[model samples]
Structure formats: C-alpha cells, structure tokens
Target chain A: MAHALTIHNLKAQIQDKPILNGINLEINSGEIHALMGPNGSGKSTLANVLMGSPEYTVTGGQITLDVQNLLEMQIHERAQAGIFLAFQYPVEIPGVTVGKFLKRALETKISGMNVSDYLKDLRTTMDFLEMDQDFINRYVNDGFSGGEKKRMEILQMLMLKPRFAILDETDSGLDIDALKIVARGVNRARGSGFGALIITHYQRLLDHIRPDFVHIMYNGKIITSGGEELVRQLEEKGYDWIKKEYNLIEEEAHEYSTN
Target chain B: MDDKGIVNTNKKSVLFDYQLNKTPKSSWSADIRKAAFQSYTQLSWPTPTDEQWRRTDITQVDIPGYNPFAIDGAHEIDVPDSVHALSLDNIMMRDTALFQSTAVPLIRKRVETATDIFEVYNLSFFNAGYFIYIPENATIQNEITIRYNFLGTHALASPHTIIIAGKNSSTDITIEHSINNNNVYIHGLTVFLHENAQCRVNIVQNISKASYFFSTGKVSLSSNAVLEYFEAHTGGSIAKTMLDAALDGSGSDAWLRGIYFGTGSQHFDLGTIQHHNANNAHSRSYYKGAASGTARTVYQGLIEVAEHAKKTDAYLTNKNLILGNTARSDSIPSLKIRNNDVRCSHGSTTGKLNKNQLFYLMSRGLSEKESEQILVQAFFEDVFSHVSGGTADKLRKIIREKISDV
Candidate 1:
C-alpha cells in the first residue's frame, strides 16, 4: 500500500508471443527486494516491459510509481519519474562517450544538475566505482569487457540516483571485486528514498546486498515468496524442487526449448 | 558584364559559336584548346546507358543557349607571389609543341583513367580554367584559398584547375566551391605531386540547392611524395564527385577523408579510387555521410593494387546514416587486387540510426531529435578527428547546424 513502485497483473509479450503471464510485484522506498528465477522465466521480459522497451508489448498490466501511471508514459518518462533499469546487456553506442551520456542525463528535467557540479560529482562517483576517470571519455560501453559493461551500468545508476531501480542480472559477468563494488554502490544508495528490485539467478550476490524480501519465479509466474528464507530454500533444494512442489505442468511444452 | 553572361540567342549548337569567339592566347594554348574542343565534339553528352552515368542523368542539362564563360568579374583569381598563375605563360607558350610547352611541368600527369563522359567533357570544353605552378622547393606557409562564385542561371561553367607541386616542394591548397544561383557546372582538377613533394588539399563543396554539379579530380604522386586530401560536401541539389589518387612512386603515401550531409531531396553520387602502382605505397580513405528527408546518397570506392605492387597497404571504409524513411543511402566498397602480396580491405554500412542506441540515449533524458543529432555528430567523429583542430571544429559547427535544419 505504501510502495514507491507497484506492479499488478503485469502481462506482456514480445513479438506477439506472451512472456509475462501475470507479474505482480511491489517495492517500498528505502527497501531492497530480490527476484530470483531460472533462465528464460520471463524475468528479463518483466524488466524490459516495465522500462517501456519498444520490443515488448504489455497486454494487461498496471505499473505505477508513487501513484503516477507508468504504462502510459514514454520510455524516458519512466526514468524521469524516478524509475531506472540497469540493463542485463547494455547496448554499445559508438561515438557517445560515458561522460556525455551522464552529462545529458544529469542535465535532464529530473536531476537539473549544472556542468561544473555535475562533472565534480561524476568524478567522485567514478572514483567510488573504481573506474578510471579516462573511462568517462571512452564510448558508452563500446569495446568494454563484460565486467566493465556491468560496472558502467552501475555507474549510471549511481549518477541517476533513481527512486526505484530494477537491476537485471548486474552480477552475471562480474568478478568478485566488481561484484563487491556494485553491491557497495547499491548499499550506499539504499536509504535515500531509493528502492530496488535486484534480479539474479544465483544467491552469491545476495551475500553482498542483503535482500529484505526474496521471490521465486517459475515460468513467468511467481510460485513462492518469503523473506530471505526463500533464497536459502532455493539455493539448497535447486529449482527442480520448487517446480515439482508447485506441480507446474509444462505450459505448452516443446520438444526443444528455443530459449 | 551583363547579369546574363554570353547568352547565345542561336540555340542551335552554341558550342561551335562559343569556341569560335574565345580565342586562345598562343598557338600552343590554341592547339590544346582546339584538340580538347574537337574531342568534346566527337563525344556527345553521356546518356543513362553508360555504366558510371546509370545512377545520374545529366542529359537534361542544356549546355547550349547559356553562357560558356564565367560572367565578367566572376573568375577574378588573386594568386599570391608563391603561386604562379599560368594564364600569362600559357599565352606565351602557344607556339610550343604539346610536350615542349613551357607549361608541360604545370599540366596533367596521369590522365583521368576512369574517363567518364563528364571528365572528357571538362577537358575538352573548359571555358574558364587556370593552371597553378608551385615552384620547386618553394614552401608556402599559408594555404592559398580559391572560392568560386558561379553566378547566373542556366549558365554553363566548366573550369579546369591544374596544381603542379614541384620536386622537393611543400604547399597547401584549399578550394571552396560555391554558387550564387542555379546553374549547370562541370569542374575538373589535375594535381601532380612530384618526387619529394608534399601537399594538402582541402575541398569544400556547398553549391546552391537548385544547381547541378559534376566534379572530378586526378592526383598523381611520384616517389616519396606525400599527399593528404580532405573533402566535405554539405550543399547541392545534385552532385557527383570522383577523386582518383595514384601512388606511382614507392614510399609515397596518400590519405583521403570525406564527409557529406544530404537532405531535402538532395542527390549525392560520390566515388573514389586508390591506385597502387609501386611497392611499399600506402593509402587510407574513409568517407561518412548522413541523409535525411527524401535525400539519396550513393558512394562507390575502389582500391586497385597492381600485379607487382607488393608490400602495399590500403584501407577503405564508407558509413552512412539515414534519418528518415524516405532517406536512402547505398555504399559500395570494392577492391581490384591483382597482387597476392598486398594488404587491402574495404567495409561499408548503410542504415538508419540504431534503435538500441536511440533507446539508450533517450533513457538518459535527451529528446529523440537531440539524441539523433548527437549520434550523427559522433558518427563523423573519427573522420573529423583526422582533420586539423580549426577545420574540424568548423565542420562540427556546420554539421550541427545542418542536422538541426534537417
């Protein structure tokens, strides 16, 4: 009821193929939530659909931030409304530098930061992320390694300073040091009107950023939800137990999974 | 000079009457002009059937009934002391043989090999032209700038320019092409960089939107000659430009960079050729362009390596960005490599802006158009980076304004 971000009956599809059957989730300000799931369980689909990616079609859903209708706004409108999604695969933009991207973003309607102050803050943020100051001059994610791309995503998140953020597998390709650095940024942004839905498969990331609540999603549906215990259960028993315990019949089973 | 220059009321073959009226300074220059005019008469204007002319149709250009020579005050060329404008000497060399003409060193070296119909036309009937002689071992610190202001509609202006950089000499030439009104113009250039010669030529073409333009360039580099050429095509309704650079001497190097932005039904046909004839020669050419509105751009480039030109290095790339549905771009990068012991590669990409890139930028607060402008500027970043600081900044400002206009 008192959530900064809320989603109800979120049904979405890509290329007319329904992926998110009905995703219901909520995140309160200053709280961190973890959505754990197997690969291709509509986790990324929900993230993209929420961020208003043009590739996906939201058939039926209501996504709101502090009572503002999100589904009706444009892709950037959602960002200006304090919603940020750290992409699982950040697009590489040749010729656009990280500094330019951050500068433009900070100067947008939301942040309204000026040039000198923005640059100073950017340098401080860059230093905190353990990124070279020269990295800001390089093209946005162009020629960046997997770990560097993820770190760049986190760097943007720190600068944007959104109210509610959805991080899609930000830990997938990071080393231990990078993982710690990213989690530290998240932890630092935790209490300042910031809430996040951290999407990941393994619980190793949970070791760094302690999730207030844990969710188990299977086949576009969240089958179980609990506090921290769900992560321990899923980690120890694996996903097969959840599938069998819930008796989730194969929804249109195929001979070979395309995904 | 009448605002309407040399208006031939007799529409039936103004070519004959025009040639008869303009007398050559010397029998030698007369012979060259007469031979060129004869060649022009033998070869009529190119039809659409020609391979090179297939994409562009210039038969609609009515060359007759219009002025052949530039109006009275339009072709006033002011040359510095370091530059020897050959108009006077050409008059003095009229009696000399073709090869023995005192201007031999100031004339063409490698004839236009890809002789399209237009190059031949320019060579034959060039009414307004000049030959520039950069004295041997003469180093001119400041670049000489020549800006052509072709005035009058339906006017026929064919200008031929020959820049001869003598042995062991270094110079820079910047030619800016501009037109006062709509006209049909054919321009040609023959540049020879002799042994140990170094030259940098910057060509800026921003002709009027209602005009038709055909331009060709032939540059030959002798052993140890270094040539750097940069061209930017920003204005014109219809334009076709071809530049051919030949590395005839070993240790010679050539670098070519070009940028073009077309919009509002504009048509650009750009082509380039890098010919390697000697061993250890190097050449790199890159061209980038942006098309919006109903504009269409066609780019074709070739890198030719001779059979014995081993150890040659060549690289070519063409990139185009389309801004709207009606905008179209075609890039053709081909190689004619006869030598097995050479390094040559070509690449091209023609497409609209990337959706992912667009989304990525918009997510950070830039409007759709602002994001596109930024990306388009960034698209030409590599090419501009090769240019001088001042020239690059000037181009950046111009491109930014043009992008906003489109």
Candidate 2:
C-alpha cells in the first residue's frame, strides 16, 4: 500500500530549544497510526508542525503529503491540500455561525458545490454525530462546552472529508460517552483511501479505533514501531521506561559530541 | 476707531437691515427676532484661547459682514430625494405653524418656555424647521425625517425642530442637514418627552466641503420616558454640535451614540451631556470618531448624576481611529456623581486598527485592503447595532461606500 503522509528526519525547535528531533514516520492509506508519548515529549509539537502551525520552527525536516511539499504551503493552503488537524485546543471565532464556517471551508476545498445541497449534506453529518441542529446556527465554538468543541471538530472533519487527518489529543478531556462517540466517528472515517494519525497520551482511544500501527515518540523521535502491542505496553507501564531509555541515549550522544 | 473700521462696522449694520427687510414677518415674529439678535450679540463666538475651541479653529468662521438670511420666500426650497429617503411623517418645519393651528399654539408655548442660549436664539430668529407632535397616547410607527439644505453663499440658515411625544406616545425622528453650496449654516433642535413616552432621534450633519455648521439640540425626559439619540457627522469645513438631555423623572432612560468621520481640512466638535435629576434614571453614551488628512475632531461627553438621584446608572465611552499622520482626535469624558448609591463609569480609547486582527483576516483569503475594510466595519458594528429600522442599513451602506473610497 502507498503512504498518504511521510515525515523524514524532522527536527523542530521552539526558541532554539529542540522539541522534535529528527523524527521519521510514514502513514499508509486505509490505516490508523497511534502516536503515544508522555507529557512534554513533542507529541503535540509534531502534530502542529505537520499542520504548518507557525509557532514551531522546522530547523531541518521534510514533510510531504503524497508528493507535495507541505512546508512550502500556507496553513489554509495545507488545509485545502487535504490536510485536516483536529486541534487539541480549538480557537473560538465569535459572530460566525458554525454552519457558515463549515460551508466556507467546504466551498474553499471543493469550489463548486451548490449551497442547498451542501446544507443538506451538513444536516446529515450533524444527525450522524447526534449534534443539535441549533448548533449549526450558533457562533463557531463561542461559549461551547469541551465536549461540544470536540464534537464540532469531528463534525468539521466529516464535512471536509480530508484525505489525511491529524487528531491531536482529541480524546484528552472528553467524558466516557463523548470518548466513545468520538472513537466511533474516527472509525467511520477509517475505510478506503482515508488515513489518520491519532496522537494521544493514553491507550483508551486505541481500543475503539484499533490502529494498524503504534509508534512510541520520545525526545522528538519515534524510538519504537510495532502493532497494537506497543500501545498496550505503554498503557500498562506508562512512559517511564521510554524516558529512561532516551536518557541513556542522550548521555551517549553528549559523550560523542565532547569527543 | 478709525474711519475704515467705522465704515466697515456701518456696512455690516446696513447689510443686516437689508437682510431683515427681505424677510417676511408674522404677528409674533418681531419679538422672537429681537430676542435672537440680542442672544447672538451676548454670546460671543468662542475664541481659539478657549479650551472647548482650542482644537476647532474659528478663523474662517469670523466673517464679520456676512448677514444672517431670513425666509424671504426668495429662494425656492427644494427638498432633496435623500431627505425623502428618510421617510419621516408628521413633519412640522418652522413654517408648519402657518398651515396647522395646533402647531402654531405649541410653537408659541415652546418659545415662551425656552431659556437656553440655543433655544432663545432659535426662537428669536427661527425662520423654518419641522415641529413634530405625537399626541397623547399616540404612537407614530414611521420615522419623521427633516432635511435642512443650505444652497447659497454665506447662507445663515436657522432651522428649529420641536418634537413633543405625549404620555405613552412613541416615535423616531431623523434630522438631516446638508449643504449643496459653499455657505455657512446654523440650526437648532428642541425636543420634549412627557411621562412614559419614548423617542429616538437620529441627527446627521452632512454639509458642503466649504461650509460652517453650528447645531444644538436640547431634550427633556419625564417619568419612565426613553430617548435614543444617534448622530453621524461626515462633512463641513467647520462643524460644532451640542446635545444636552435632562432625565427629570424616575425610570427615565437615555442612550446616545455618535460617529464622526472627517478628512481634508475639516474641523468637527461635539459636546454631549446626560443629566440625571431623578431616581432610577439610567444613561449610556458611546461615540466613535475617525479622522484622516489634516482633519481634527473633538468629543466632550458629560454624565452628571444629580444629588438625591439614588440608583442612577451612567456610562460614557469614546473611541477614535486616526488614519493619517496629521489627523487628530480629542476625547474628553467627564462624570459627576452626587449620590452615594449611583454607579458611573467613563472610558476613552484612541488608536489605529489592530494589526493582528487585520493579519488574521488577511490570512483567511481576504486581501489586505479587504481585511482593513472588514475590521473597520466590525469596529462600528456595536455602534450600528443600536440603530434600528432601514436607517441602520442605509448608514451601513454609506459607511461602506465611504471606506471603499478611502
């Protein structure tokens, strides 16, 4: 199977402090990859870099969506090029209705859909997500609850239907019912020609989505890659073992640098 | 004085006589005319040394030989289509008395009850304006629009409007002033709201580029009465407007919103007062101004909660957006609270547009110029929301058109 996204030797920094250090990963189509890491292990950093967030500087890296260079494009351009990022902390845009914003994004993406048919499609997606129809008319995430924000993100993803998506900690603060709903929504997008990078701290989300590959990220690098067993091991033991192992590797690198 | 100076002064007196002779006179018009001439003589034109006149240069306004024109019926008064666009009914101009018996008696009464300099001046030298009276317990659904257009050289136009909203009556009145010719114009408006009445007044001053405009409005609100006053100042070489309101009874409310946009060598000055004299009265004021080129604007707003007026709540704010290096704006908001239980606050902010907001909008596919226009429209949204009916939409269109030209 061909890969949908490829990140090679990605090294990123924030104000000269390394966050993502020479990380390499490839996500294939029709597959879900789980990126599990402890706190401050550059999990969110990698997601932001892939989404072309300006906060993180790419010191040395190459991120490609199929054959297109992702780094050369603007944020909205990246979004238009079929890269969707479900932010860990979504921004609130006041006075703009959710339906209007979704329609704008969709129009920018597809460029030719009729408004009435687009609205009908949106209503269908809202029904699938069990979202209140009134939410579509309300301001975009303005005064929305945490669960509503997460659900709205999923709703946008469904409306846009991007080829590659980065779900950055989408299950972090959701309730059990909300988590299940979110997992079900993600699984619905998991078939043919769709690829997702699910970045999370816990293995609970993996149980529902059942990723094809699990990767452990530490010190900005993917140290281990395996099947679902890696996620289970990280859930059982936590990231302490990986931290210890990376500390040894860092000591060895420092010794080599001094010599 | 020298012979040249005496000759010049005598010439001005002779000019005044000729102008007065050209005006038509009614039975009680002589008394009012005498009073106005006396008031104009007593109140001197504000000097540049005065704090209120510091920002507004009156050098060009010091024309000594320009005689005040009276309604001689020599010039045909053509009401512009823009005036009709306002769609105001029950309009009573200063001439409204000639046709209506009730309006004449009411004007006489208002002239008798007047005390302020502007009111006395208007009553004394008033030639024409609209006198709108919403009778007791009557509601006028349509807005009453009155237009005062000055169309000649050195035209001293004194137009007066007296609005009486009786108990339980409600109405909206829009007073629009425009000058097609380069001339001088002065006008005054006096409004009275009885117990439980509601009135919304929107005043627009769009004079000629080479004209001077001086306007004053006085309003009195009774128990449970409400007044929403809005003004848009966009023209004139020199313009000074004063709006004073007295909330005299319990449960009375007053809201004042204004916008002044100027360019070139224009000078605009505005003074507003919200006086709370009774308990439970509330007042709010928001005024925004934008200046470009060498245009200057001054906004002075006062909120006074009288003694023993308990539970009075008042707020006043003024914001200015300076678009040019030579453009300047002065905002002075004053609050006087006499009661211990009253709540009062005032704030003023002067700055250019936020670059971050512009960048954010531009990043979302809008051009930089388009982004600026959106931010400007958004900045005026809060002020526009207070405007109701088709007038608000019209004002929005006008603002958008003007911004695009910039």
Candidate 3:
C-alpha cells in the first residue's frame, strides 16, 4: 500500500507569530504538487511543520501519512516515517564530514545497503550533482558555497529516498546547470511510492520538474489552486494580481461581516 | 615542618619512608630532592579557597590509603636500538657512560621545585621515572616507548620522566600511565629540546576511574628546536594536569594538542601556559574536551609574551562540549602580552552540540544519542588531526567506547 500525506485545516505558528492558518493540502503517493507562494506566505513554514520541526508549533490541525498520525511522532520519527525536507538554507556542521553523516542517515533510512554498494551509490549521486567525490569527506555544509549547499540538500534527498519530500526553495540559489541536476535527482526519485511538494516563488523550477497540481498561497492560506496554467499566470503577473484578488476577497468578507 | 606534614598521616609516612630509603642515594639528586622536600614540607596543602586550586578540591583525596614503590624494572619496556632509554634511578644506581654524556646536567636542572605545591610534591616523592637521551644529530626511526603500570595495593604512585633531545637530533617518544588497581596516580614529565632538535611527545594517561590522577610537566626549547606535544587523557575519576612550556630559544616552535573525554562523576582540570621568552618564536595550543553524565571539566590556557620577545606568534584555543544537563564545562583562556610587536590571541568556548546540527542528523534518521555521538566525535576531530600514527585511531576508539557509556 502506498502512502499519501493529508493535511487538514493545518494551523501553525513560530514564537507566537502565526505562519500557517487553515492550510489544507493533500498529495497522493505518485503525484507531484507545486506550492507557489510569495515571500513570507507560509510556504517554508508548511514544509518545516510537516517535518515536525520543534521551532514550529502546530496550534490546530491534523496531519497524517496514510493511517499514521504524523503529529504524534518526534522530529526524527517523522523522518523515519518517510518525511523529508530540503532546506532552503542548509546548516553547516563542523567536524562532521558529509560522507559519515549521510552514511549514518542511510543506515537508518535504508538499513539493508551494505558498505560497498552504498559507497558506489554515493559516488554516483555526487557525480550526478557535479560535486567532487572528495566532498563526501568534507564537513557537512561547512564553508560550502550557496550552490553547493543547495545541491547537497538534493543529494541528501536522493540518498534518503523518502516517501514524501518537501523541497523548500531548493531551486532558488542554483544556477541552470545545478538546477538541472537537482531536477534530475527529483525526476529519478519520482513515481511509484514517492511524492513531493515543491515550494518555490518562481516557475523556473516548475519548467524543469512539472507539477501535477499548482497552488497559490497568500496571507497564510491557499487562496487559489489549479494546474500548469496557474504557474504561468502567476509568473506573468508577478504576484501583484494575486495580491489584488486576495485583497478584493478580504474586502468582500469585511463588508459582509459589517452588514 | 617535615614531622608536621608527614607525622599526622603516619601510614602515608611509612609508605613515603619505604620509598625514600629504597631510592639508591646520589648526592646530586639527593640535594635536589632535599630542597624539594623542604619546600613540600613548608607549603601546606592547597584548599578550594585558593584561586588556582579553587576548581580542584582535595578534601576527599586520601594519601594514606595507597602505597608507592618501584613499578618498573630492567627490560620492563623494550628500548629501541637507536635511542638511549633508561630509568633515572638506574642511572643514579650506576654511573653509566650515557649518564655522563646526557643525564648528568639535565637531571640537575629539570626536577627542581616549582611554584605549585603539587609540583613540589612531584619533585620530592616521585617513586619511579625514566630518562631518554637522543644523541646529537642522530635520528631514531622507532619511537622510544615507556610505561608505568600501577599494580598491587599502592596508595600513591608518582612516576617521572625527563626527555632530552640533543642538538640536531630527532625522535618520537610515548609515555603512557596506566593502572590495574585503585590508587592515587601522579606522574611528572620534563622535556628539554636543544638547538636544532625536533621531537614529538605523545602522552596517554588512562587510569581506572576509581583513582585520582595528576600530571605536571614543563618543556623548554632551545634555539631552532621544534617540539610537538600531544596529550590524550580519557580515564580517571578525578584528573588534573598542568603543562607549562617555555619557548626559550630564538626561532623555536612548539605545538601542543590536548584532547580529553570525561564521563561519570569525573572532575578534570587541565591547564597550560605558553611562555614566549625569545624573539621570533612560535607556539600554539589547541585543547578540545567533552564531558557528559554528571562530569565536570575546567580548562585554563594562557599565552604570555615576555617584554623582550619581539615578533613572537602564539595562539591558544580551548573548545569543550557538554553533553547532558548535569554535565558542565568552564573554559578560561587568557593572554598577557608585554611586547607590542608580538601576535598573541586566545579563545575559549563551552557549548553543547548544536541543536540545529542535531536536528539535521536526526532528520537523516539518526537517534538523538547517535546524532550526539557523531557530533561529539566531530567536535574532537580538530585535535585528533594533530595526533599521528595509531594514536589518533586509538583515541577515536576510546572516544566511541566512552560515548557508548555517556
């Protein structure tokens, strides 16, 4: 049985500041969704909340992966349950080399891979990401350039092979060459039992990895959702039109409340 | 004062007397010992009220409960062909050609009384010790190794070592202190590097956690000499060590890397002083430590540049990782620079494993403990890289073992 992530009326906040208000989304095991939003419109918050980041407190909502309650598990438990987040700003861990950290992670995520085969696969992924094989021996994201950090995030996703991955602006800092490799990593890992919620502010990434569904997020909620056309409309209008439309909706609600 | 110091602890005096009577008398060392003993007798035991000994309290430490004697004999450790390695007592027992060539002058100047009381005790009652002499312009390919193993019911064991590298000579030396039974452990070391000499000292101290361990040492470098000192301390219930180094020779260089792993209720106090005495000398000290389980650690490092020492470069860094809520680490790194032309900097930081780093590892599916263990190992890797041979690997193995119990 394949897994499907269902988030119902999700509400979350960080430091008592509300980020996600009544966010409802679902992605089947084989579907890819593009979550396009303006800056500070709760896209990153949703991804972080889905991974059970301790910084984000879920004020109200129910999140489930198939029949398992995702909210009931700890952060690592959420990872073990197959939830992955590709951070926009990856952290640097001094003294911990990339190869060792990934090996430990893979051992827990996919325990059956032996050392020799794992090394081979890791080499392949490094090669695909246009990274030097020596990088696997370097400290995790320690002193890495912006592009390298983003590529490393995608490389981790490829290694973990999670059932669902939320890529939060992973395509922002990447050049076209690096962006293709990241898209290629996602493309190869797609379908079967894998799904992804690709969150971004631009349609450039959607051009590489097309989403089955598209969503427009504003004011901590998804005000509109559609297919490929939605991405083009937003990219052409540059979010100003969406802001105007959401403003009209807010004005209508306010007037109705007053009457 | 002697009676006042030893008479109250008669059991300790009997052990000390047996040790004193057994040491074959040599006028040179006897005079040195007599002076040191006088200082030791006059100086009262330091209490927690005193600033230097404030972090290290000896109220619970008992001297009479243990014994001390000759713990090493002839051929107890194999001596490589290219180096002269023998006990100081043995040299005092029989005046050897090597003694005349190397030991006579260094022994006279090495183990005299210092300012500290415990070091004064080391100068007075070191039960056993070794002296290794590397001949001038000679290179010893094999590392000269020595061990002082405490066995039987010894209440106190103080083994000392003095290493002198002759001019233009090069060698590696490893001095390890270990114990199979419970006792108070104290070892002393004095290293002398002559002009153009190059030497590396690897000191590994791993006593049973049931004992209290203390080590005090001083190293002096001559002109154009280079000394690399590494100390890896892992065991002992309560451990304290002070390493004072003087870069006395112009163009001399010194590198000190100290790494320790403390767990349980252990209290570890590690201190170092880099004294820049000559112009154009370079010295660096990097100390990394971790404490978990109710353990506490204190690290005090100082880099002092004398007034006449111009163009000297000295650096000191102390990094400590505390694992649990009950575990604590205090790092105090200071500098006293008297020369304006010198470059000296010191920094100390005590922190836990980064929570974000922990989450990054945990997000990769590692348990919290596993994440912490990896980060802890990573935390010490900076210092481990300074260690060479199988010693770094050995330290890594011990760290893993300790982490399993942390």
lDDT of each: 0.79, 0.74, 0.83
Question: Tens digit of lDDT per residue, candidate 1, span B1-406?
Answer: 2333334353323654455456654444455555555555556666779766677676776654456554322554556887776542254435334334434443422222334556766655665666677889999887676667677666766777778788999987777777757777778888889999999888878878888878888888999999999888887888998998999999899998899999888889898999999999999889999999988888888899999889999999898989988998988889999979998998888888888888878776677788888889889888877666666777778778888888
Ranking by lDDT: 3, 1, 2
Candidate 3 - CAPRI tier? medium
Docking class of 1: medium
lDDT of 3: 0.83
Candidate 3 stretches greater than 4 Å from native: A247-259, B1-14, B26-32, B70-79, B88-93, B141-144, B152-154
- Candidate 1 residue pairs in backbone clash: B26-B94, B27-B94, B28-B94
Candidate 2 residue A105 Cα shift, in angstroms, is 4.2
lDDT tens digits, residue span A82-101, model 2: 77888787766554567766
Give TM-scores for every candidate, taking all chains together and pairing residue i with residue i.
0.86, 0.76, 0.92
DockQ of 1: 0.50
Please provide the root mean square deviation of candidate 3 (C-alpha atoms, Å). 4.0
What is the Cα-based lDDT of residue A5 in candidate 3?
Answer: 98
